[model samples]
Target: MRAIRSLSQGARTSLRQVLWGLVLVLALPTILVAAAGLYSGYRAEQQATDLRMQETARALSLLLDREIEKSVLALQVLAHSSSLARGDFEEFYDRAKTSGLEEPSWIALFEPSGRVIFNTRVPYGVKLPNSNRMDALQRVQETRKPYVSDLYVGSLTGQRLITIDAPVIIDERVAYILSLAITPDVFQGIIRDQRIADGWNAAVLDRSRRLVARSRSPERFVGQLASPNVQEALASAQEGLLQSVTLDGIPVRTYFSQSPTYGWSFVISIPETELAKSAQRSLFWLTVLGAVILGGILLAVLLSRAISKPVDQLVAAAQTLGRGGEVSDRASTRVLEFDTIKRALVEAAAGIRHHEREREEVLAHMAESEARLRLALNAGHLGSWEYTPATGALTTTPTCRAHFGRGADEPVTYADLIAQIHPDDRALQKESVALALAGRTDLQAEYRVIWPDGSEHWIRVSGRMRSGPDGHPSMVGVSQDITERRLAEDRQALLLHELNHRVKNTLATVQSIASLTRRSGDNTDPAAWNAFMDRLHGMAKTHDLLTATQWQGALLEDVLKNELEPYQDGIRQRIRLRGPRINLQPGAVLALGLAVHELATNAVKYGSLSAAEGKVHVMWAVTSGSGQPALLVEWVESGGPPVNKPERQGFGSKLIQRGLAQQLGGEIKLDFAPAGVRCVITFPISTMASDQSGAAETQQRYAS
Candidate 1:
């Protein structure tokens, strides 16, 4: 204690020393607070960057998994094709070629012995290269499930690619392995299309820790092993953030996400420099504040006695500002120097508040603009893009990323964007882009993009080119999904073709009915002519009913009602009809209509309808027979006269028993009851009963 006191006394308490002491006291806390604020802000920014990286990696992982699943699904669908099942290798090869032409994927069928049976890239019977990998095929055969292979050099194309294989099961055994081979170029395109900020990087690693693709410097690093630090970080967790160095030896803040489906990982790495920017800015401001405070303290020391009150007030105000608190307006001191200083403090506070409010307003406007952009993109199914030809940079909206089957935050290049387009459409798209860039024409193209999952979409793109201030060409455009419109067009064509087929069938039927009617009797016979006309009218009624139902089928009750319409009278209940409603195909409708007409004619001439007191009771029902649903119809007559069997089978009887049976794919039985005539028809309900339920259930349900 004596030594420290003696040293302090030797230093001497000069006026400048005292002022320096005061400045130290005032500046220490402010400096400490500023350092703390800087650190806190740095931490917040670092955390935000990590979170964003994690989210991007996770999203990219999910997209890759979905793409793998889609490829497997496509292979499965191809495996089940009838052509493949029939062992028509030539036909199947043609179909596979056409299907994969857009994707530029090679579709192949391989035997269990690892021999290629068919490949879309080569002629039939050509053998695949010996080095072609068959592990995925073997796995599919063993598991009888789809399997996606790891990245490898495809022996046929001598390119880095992956294969997705599905087993074709036949007679409870694996008959063949269907495979779809895709190149890494597609996945590279996916990585390149991510919308990452500048200086950030992303990569996709296969199960082997080999880089399958990278968003930056892909051509340089793809197929190489990932950095040891990244591999170590991933080994510990399926998803996490870490501080690491990239393959290029640059330090970065990295995040990784592993895919459960494909055993692959997506990684996002942001340069550490980006996180340091905010901290550096904070330090700059702190240094400037310290300098200003030191200058003020020196001035205060010189005029220490005269400016004591003002300096104290100024210090308080500075502390308030440093703490980000509002300053209240004060009355003028009336002295010029004091008032000037006070006014400056107030104006500084006002300026800070004004800037803060402006910053908030700007942030709000940016958020609103983003929201509106999202709404427009979603509502219109639109993907917007901006392309700079010189830089080859293709910036896209979130919807555009989705359209290209990329993660929302992925960056894209012009080459990567064009590569995602279907091979068949790439030439045209390239030409259109060239024309636009050359200022020869506005760009417009309708093309297809084959996604990594093997799903294809039609896209219509429209854009205009503009010259930048530096005279470089750029394009602004929107792409819309037009798959639905294309499908509707296809459906319309199919419907038109079906309409033509039905019209020809109808004409043939009319011609046959006319010939049959003419041959049954002489054309001169008026009764025969009348019978033909009546039959024609009955056929027309059936057709009308069928037309009303769009030719899907006609209700049995509707057909019966039309045939019995001529016999109905206001006062007489001569015909009684009872049945559960049944739907019949067009063929059943025609045969049944003629049979009912014949029966009615017979009843009018010789059965119950022959006398006023006579009555006809017609009933139909669905019943189970031979373990299949069957339709049963009964015709009974009463109160006319004693019924007798026909001497010889008439045309009506043969038509009802034979023609009706053949047309309906069912059976018929004619019964001659003692008191009246009865006919019972039984037919399989396969075609006639649209609903397979028993007639009793149907009737009960209808009643309810």
Candidate 2:
């Protein structure tokens, strides 16, 4: 032992160095591990950033596509103007002005030669420069379809604008080109409204790679070509992510999508630093770990222990943040790096809270919008539904459920929905759904549905098929109850048919009246013709009364008042007309009208109405005769020249006797009383009473 102790201290120092070397070798992997961790973290951040950018780009692309589609739809509507088709330029300009007044962009109509015929922004006589490249217009004219043009400077306003052109085809020839000019301000607003991340920029490019709109510094970059790298990337793919430098020499990670409607590209470029921030933090921590490794072994152990506790605390805080929990200030570990991580966790928590609040607000707005939609549907008697063909699942709004006579909470399958349809309409509904799902055509059908209560309702359904997230077929549609409208149309058709029939019957009656008058030699003299005309006037007054009653029936009092109106004008007090408010059937009204006409004519000529001192009393009563109800009408005249029986029955008298007896199924007696003339007419009331009751029932049923 003494001899070993005699060895140099250098040997002991060398053994210690070897042990330290082994420890250094083992610690070298820690640096490598930290580097690998930093790289992995950077890759993850890049992936996340890419996903966000792609989503933003897609959303912007969809919004721009919708705007273009709206412009096209508006142009198509304007193309159908009747004035444009009729070659009325002045009228067409007026209509276009009215239509464009509320639009965000201006509208113009151009001749086939690219000459402005009408412009909403300028007067009719104002001349404007023609486009050097009229590819959009020419394409629309050739294809007879809508076309969206590349960005250009407006000739009138000198502002950057894009045009959507639709051809107005008449008689299989292009007649006019309707164009709508939209400014970049519209797309600028859309980009701003999207709430993109700070330090992130978005831009829109036309098919030619020219900048149509830029979310940042629009005035400087708009109308300029995009960066060469961006153009090359977009040219190769419809949508993708890539790293490119902006025109201002700022490197960015970009996501771009090409629009299907306009061939435009939407780009969302996030600054590279945003993605590098996480990697920088990781590298900084790795450097700190390497520095700790360079310290003495005991110091390294102490430093690791010190760093480990704070790191554990930071990890717990991060986990809490990931779970959407609030981070407390007590999470601070008093270590600079760890404290920074804690602060970042707290900020992340705050960001999550903010995002949650926004989500809640969005949900509330969606609820309000849904409520408004329901109210509108109820007001219009409309219902909406969605059906998934794969699952046979049907989702219906409350209004739609009610239309099918289903409870609010009832689960409805596609088959259940089909079952509610009327048997005659079920096949049609099935065929329409099949066609829609097959992408053959849109679904549109007017059909009847039978409710559980045994009542049928006519409903019009219109919808289109769409692909779900998984590419499965689904249908979204609206239904409207058109029962009342259908019934009204039916009533109108019946009225028209009745009008035609009544006109034919009236014409035949007029011929009969003329023939009867001529056979009686009434046309041989002027006085006779005048008397015949007066008789015809009486018939005309009765016809007016019947028409006013919708040909359903006329009141007995109304018939008498019409026939006696002329005679009673001068002798109001002398004429006494009284009767109960009895409704007569149309047939009864016509027969009674003729009989009253004859009676009035005779009275005006030779009876009480013919003299100043003459008086007439007309009355009717409902009385029981032979156990059946009967209407008894008596027309008596007094205070006139003494009445005498005619030698031969004239047409007037014969009409009252024969027509009243045959047409009214009644009895009539005319007595030549010395006091005056008295006529008694008796008819059974069964027909009129039954007819009145039936009409009342029909009206009540319809009302119910």
**Candidate 2 on 1-704: residue-level lDDT in tens?**
34434653335543345556666787888889878988897788778767877877887898788878876886787788888888998887887777743246788888778887867788876777775447777888889998887888876577888888889988679999988888888777778888766688899898998998888889999999999999999889999988899987899988999988788889988898887787778888888887777765656455556656656676677667767788667664354565698899999999999999999999999999999988888888888998887887788877778777877777777777778899988888888877777774689988888887789888898888888888887888888888898999999999999889877766665665666677677434345566568767766887788889778887888888887777775537888887655788766777788888888778888888888889888888776535666777899999898898887777777666665666568888888888899888888777654244322323221000
Clashing pairs in 1: 193-411, 194-410, 194-411, 195-409, 195-410, 195-411
Q: TM-score: which candidate is best? A: 1
Clashes of each: 6, 0
Question: How well does each candidate superpose onto the true structure, as a TM-score?
Answer: 0.44, 0.43
Off by over 4 Å in 2: 1-382, 389-392, 402-441, 450-456, 466-472, 521-525, 565-573, 577-580, 621-632, 657-667, 682-704
RMSD of 1: 16.2
Q: Model 2: clashing residue pairs?
A: none
